[model samples]
Target: MSRKTLIPIGPYHPLQEEPELFKLYCDGEIVTDIKWETGYNHRGIEKLSESKSYDQVFFLVERICGICSTSHPFAFANAVEEIVAVEITDRAKYIRSIIGELERIHSHLLWVGLAGHFLGYNTVFMWAWKYREPVLDLFEMITGNRNSYAMFKVGGVRRDIENSKIPAIRKEIAVIRKKIDLLTGAVMDDPVIHARTKGVGILTRQDIIDYGAVGPTARASGVDIDVRRDDPYAAYPLVNWKVITAQAGDVFAKAEVRLLEMYESASIIEQCIDALEKMKEGDITLKINEIPEGLGTGRAEAPRGEVFHFVVSDGSNSPARHKIRAPSYTNIATFKKSCIGQTIADATLSLAAVDPCYCCTERMAAAYDNSSGKKILNANELIALSLKRTSELRKSGTGHE
Candidate 1:
C-alpha cells in the first residue's frame, strides 16, 4: 500500500494572491484527501462598519476586495437604501448600473488573465490584462480611482457620468468589444486549453447546490441563478441582457461563462450609456438624512458570485449590526468536491476554477475572549482544534472525507 504524502499549497503561495493554507494528502500523484485553513486575512470589516457612519461605510467596504471594490459599495448602498426607502432618479440608476457592469467586465478580464498565468499561458494573460486596462480607464474617466471607486452611496452614486464623456466612453467600449471577441475566440478554440481544462475540476449542479456556491461557479454547473436577474436591482432590469451559463461545470465551463458574460456586461453598459445620454445629469443622489430602525438585506451579482450585505439600523448614522458575505465563502468550499479525485498537478487549477478571492472570503471565526476583549486562541491553537474536530467527525462516520 502506498502511503499518502502531505503537500501544502498555501498560507502564502505564488499561485494564490492572498494568504490561505490548503493541506493536500496524496498517494504519489493522486490527491486522496484535503483540508484548508482561512482567517489569515481577517480585517474585521463588519465590526469596522459599526464604527463608521452611513456615508463613510461605502468607502470602508469598497476596500473589501480590490477587484470587486464597486460590488461591496453597490450591495451596501442597496441595503441602506432599503432602510431609507427612497427612490433615486432614472439617471442615477443608469450610472450605478454602468459602474457595476463595467466592474464586472474588469473583474472577469482580471480573472482570465490570472487563470492564464496559472496555466502558464502568458500570452493569454498579457492579452486579457491589456484589454482590462480600457475598462479601468473607463472607471478612471468616471471616478478618480482605478481600483477603489467611491461612487455608490445610500440612494445613488457620488459622481455623474456626464453627457460630454459619452462619445469617448462609447469609442472605448467599441474597441474593448473587438478585443474581447479576439480573446474569447483565442481561448475557446485553443486545443491546448481544451486538453488542459475541459474535464478538469468539475463541480456538478448538485455539488453547487450542496456547497451553496454562487456566481460563475454555480452558473457554470448549469445552475442558472443570478442575483441581478432574480432580485432585479439597479438598471439590470431596465437594460436588455441575459444571464450566462454553461453545462459542463469544469474549469473550461467557468472560463466560458465569464468570457460570454463580458459580452452581456458590455451590452448592458452600452444600453446604460445610451440611457445616460437621453437623461439629464446632476440628479445622482437623493437626500437621505437618517435611517430609521430596521433591518435590510441587499445582494448584488458580483463578478465572482453574490455579494450580500445585511444592515441593522438603530435609528442612528451608523449600523447597529452589519454583516457581509462574499461569494467565495461558499464557492471555495466546493474545492473539496472538485479536487479530491484529481491529480496534484490539477489541484491548483481546481482551486482557481472558482476564481477564489481569499481577501473577500475572510471572516472572523470567533477567536475573541468576550470578558477580556482579547483573542483567546492563536493560529496554531485554532488549527489544532479544527483538526481535532475533523478527526472526531470522520471517526464517527459523519464526515465526507
Candidate 2:
C-alpha cells in the first residue's frame, strides 16, 4: 500500500532565488495533492514606487525581478508615457524594441539551460548557457549593466543604438540565431526528453482560461495571446514578427514555443536595427514636464508573459498609487490544474514551465504537511526528490514507477 507523504520545496534553496515553498503530496511515485506559498522577500516595491518620482520609479521597478528587470520598467514606462500623452521618436521606439528583444533572447536561453539541468542533460544546459552569454554582452555594451539595464525612461529610451555598433550587434544576433536553431532541433529530435516532458504536466486550455495564464505557459496550451501582437507598444507595432504557440500544454510545448519565439525575437531586433538606420539618430529620448492627474496603464510582453503596471498621478512627481502585476501571478495559479495528478518528478518541471522569477515566487511562500499541519522537507530535499525521479526514469526507460 502506498502512503501519503509531503515534500516541500523552497524558502531558500541553493538553486532558487525567490524562496518559494511548494507542498507536494505523493502516494508512492504519483503526486496526489499540491499547494504553493509565496511572498518571502516582500520588499514592498509597489509601495516603494509610490515614494519615488516618475523618473526614479524606472530604476526601482527594474529591481523587481532580476530576470525580468527590463520588463517591469518597460511596462512602468509605458504607463508614465500614457499619463503624459506623448509618443516617443521613431528612433527611440526602435531602440526600445532592440533592448526588449535582446532581453528575451537571453531569458529564453537561460530557461532552456535550467530546464536541461532539471532533466540531467548537462550538455544541453551548457550549450544553451553558452549562447546566452553574447546576449548579456550585448546588454552590457548597450546599457552598462548586464542584469539591470537602466535604459527605459518615461518619455522614451535613455540610450541610443549607435550606427557604429549596429554591425557588431547584428553579427552577434546572427550567430546567436544559428545556435538557437541548433538547440531547438536537438531538443525536438530527442526521444527520451520527449518521454520526460510530453503529456507530463498537461494544463488544458480551459485551465489556462480559468487561471489567466500568460506567456509561453498559455501559448503552449494553444491560447494565442501576446501583448506585443494584441496590444502593440514601443517598436513592436512597427516590426514584422509572429507570436509562437503550441497545443500540447506540457513542458515540451512550453520549451518549443520559447525556442521558436527566439527566432522571432532575433528577427525583430534585426528589423529594428534596419529601421534605426533610416531614422534620426541621437533622438532616442523625449523631454517631459510634470505629470497630470489621471490613471495610466501599460503592458509589455515580458520573457515569461505579460507584465502589467497601473499608475495613478495627481499632479505630483510621485505616483499616488502604483500596482504591478507580473505574469507569474496568474501563471503560478495554474499549478493547481497541472500538478494535482502528476508524478512527483513532473511537478518541478511544470512549475518551471512558467519560467517564474524564483525570487518573485519565493517572495511569498510557506510549506507544510497538509495532513498533520507540520513542516516537511525543505527546498533542497524537495529538489533532490524531484531529481531522483528523473534519474529513475532515465535508468528504467519509463517515467512512471
Candidate 3:
C-alpha cells in the first residue's frame, strides 16, 4: 500500500507575516515532493512606478522594504543619475558608501536576531536586537531618521558629514566593532545554535546556481558573484575589502557568511571615513537641464541579495515603464526545491535561512476563519494547527514543509 500525507505551513506565522503556502507530499518520515504558492502580497508597485516620475519613484522604491530602504533609493538614484550623465562629487560618493555600509551592518544584525527568534533562542534574539540599537542611533545621528534615511538626492546626497561630527562617528563605529566581535564569538561558540542550524537545509553549489540564488545565499554555496565586485558601482571599487564566501551551503554556513560580512562592512566603512577626511568639498549635485528619452538599468548589493531596477523614460517627467527585481522574489523561489526531503521541524528554519523579507514580498490580506459555521479559526490559529499537523507528519519521519 502506498501512503501519502499533506502538510501546509503558513499564510501567517510569527516568524513571517507574508502569506506563502508550502505543500509537502511525504511518505513516512521523508518528504517526497514540495510545492509553493506566493503572490499573496503582490502590491503592483512595479506597475505603479510607471505613473511616477524618476524623482518620485525613489520614494516609491524605498517602500519596497523597511530594512533596506536606503539601498533602494541609492540604487534608483544611481540609475536616474546615469541616464542624465550626472557626475556626483567624490565626497558625496564616499558619504553614500559609508551610510550604505552602516545600513548593511544593521541589516545583518537584524537578520541575526530574526534567525534566533525563529529557532526559539530568545536570549540571542534579545541580545542581538539590543546591540543593533547603536547602529540605528548612528544612522539617526547622521541622517536625522532611524528607518528612512533620506540622504540620497537626485544629483548627489542631501547632506554632507560635517567636520564636527567626525570624531563622534569614529567613536561610534569603534563601539559597534567591539559588539560585533562579542556577537561573533557567541554565534561561533554556542552549542545549541550549531546543533539546530549547522547541518540543516543544505543547498549545494550546483543547486544554488541552478536555482539562480543571489546575495549571501549564493555566496554561502561557494558562488563568487557580487555586484559590487562584478559591476563596480559607486565607490565600491575605490574601497578595499574582500568578498566573503563559504563552501558549506547550509544554514550555519549562511549565518557564518553574514557574520563575517559584518567585519568586511566595518572595514569598508573605515575606508570611507578615511576617504571622506581627505576628500575636498564641491557641488554635491549637478544641474540637469533636461531629461532625454532613455532606458537605464541599475543593480546594487542589497543586504538580502541583488536588487535590480530598470527604468525607461520617454522624455517625460514620469517613466514609461519601471521594473523592480527584488532579491526576495528570487530567493523565495528556491524554497520549493530546498524543502523537499526535510523534516517539518526544519521547515521554519530552512525557509527563514534564506532570510526572507515577507513585508517586502507579500501584500496584506484580511485574515478569515475558514473552519465553518461551528467555529472560525483566525489566521494565527490556522498557522498553529498547520504546525501541529506538520509535527504529526514528521513523527513518522516522512514529512516536509
Candidate 4:
C-alpha cells in the first residue's frame, strides 16, 4: 500500500513573500490535491476607512497597497466625485490617465521581474528590474514620490503637468516603449519561461465568471471584462484603446496579456500627452461647497485588476461606511481550483499567474498558541514573523532546501 504525504509549501515559502499557507497533498512529485489558508496580513483597512473623513481617507487609501496606491485613491476619489457631482477639467482627466498608465508600466515591470526571480532566472529578473527603474524615475519626476504619488484629489488632481515637462514626458515614453518591446520579446522567446508557464495552470471562461475573477486573471481566461471598457471613468471613455485578451486561460496567457497590455499602456500615455498638449489651461479642481448624504461606488482597472470602492456619507465631513473590493480579493479565490493536480514546482508560477497583491487586499486570521492554549498573535504579527524568517533564510543561504 502507498502512503499519503502532506507537504506544506508556505506560511513560509521562497516562492511567495506573502504569509499564506499551501498544503499540498501529494504522491511523490505529483500533487493530488491542494488547500490554501490565508490570515497572515489582514489590516482591516476597509473598517479603518469608515473612521476617516473624505479628505483624510485619500491618504489612508493610498496605504492599501504600495504598488496600486494611485489607483486606490483614484477609485476612492471617483466615488466621492460621483456623489458630489464634481466636474473635473479635461486637462485633469488627461493627467489622471497619464499617471495611471505610468503606474501600470511600473507595476507590470515589477511583476515580470518578480516572476523571473521566482523561476530562478536571476538574469531575467535583473534585466526586468533594470528596465523598471526608468519608469519609477519618470513617476518621481511628475508625482514627487516613487510609490505613493498622492496626486489624485477628490475633485481632481493636485497639480497640472507643467508645459515644459510635456516634451520630456514624450521623450521618456518613446525611450521606454523601445526598451519594453525588446524585453517583452525576450520573455516570449525564452524557452525556459515558456516551458514553466505555458499550460501550467489554466482557468476556463466559465470558471472565471463563476469565481468572480477580474483584471488579467479573467481576461486570460477569455472573459473580456475590463473596468476601463465596462465602466469608464476619468478619461478612459474618451481615449482610444482596446482591452487585451487571451483564450489559452493559462499562465502563459496571463503573462502575454500583461506584456501586450504594457504596449497598449504606452500608446495610451502617448494619447494622453497629445490630449494634454491641446487642452486649454484652467482649474484642475472644483470647490467642494458641502457634502450631501448619499452612497457612491467607483470602479477602475488597476494594474492587477478591477479595484472597487464604496463610500457612504451622512451629510458630514466623514464617511459613514467605506468598503474596498480589491481585485486580488476576487482573483485569489480561484487558487485551489487552478493549483490542484499539478506538480509542486508549478505552484509558484501558478500563484504568480493571478498577480497576487498581499499588501493591498489581505485580511489576517487570528493565530493560536498551542503551548499557551490561547490566541497569542494577530495576523500582522504572523506576517512579520514569516517575512522575517524568509529574509533570514535568504541571507543565510539555507531556506528552500
Best-fitting candidate, scored by TM-score:
1
Q: Which of the two, 1 or 2, has more TM-score?
A: 1
What value does the lDDT take at residue 85 in candidate 1? 81
Give per-residue CA lDDT, model 2, range 276-296, as digits (tens).
Answer: 777767987778878899999
TM-score of each: 0.91, 0.89, 0.86, 0.89
Rate residue 354 of model 1 by lDDT: 96
lDDT of 1 by residue, 255-307 (tens): 99999999999999999999889887798888877799999998998999999
Count of clashing residue pairs in every prediction: 1, 15, 7, 4
Q: Which pairs clash (backbone N, Cα, C closer than 3 Å) in model 1? A: 215-305
Candidate 3, which ten residues in sequence have the lowest lDDT sum? 363-372
Checking candidate 4 for backbone clashes, the offending pairs are 39-364, 39-365, 42-363, 42-364
Tens-digit lDDT string for candidate 3 (182-267): 99999889999999998888988888888888999999989998888897777898989999999998899999999999999989
Q: What is the lDDT of residue 135 in candidate 1?
A: 88
Give the winner by TM-score: 2 or 3. Answer: 2
lDDT pick, better of 1 and 2: 1
- Candidate 2 weakest lDDT stretch, 10 residues: 358-367
- Give the Å shift of residue 400 in candidate 4: 44
Q: Can you tell me which runs of candidate 2 are displaced by over 4 Å? A: 361-401
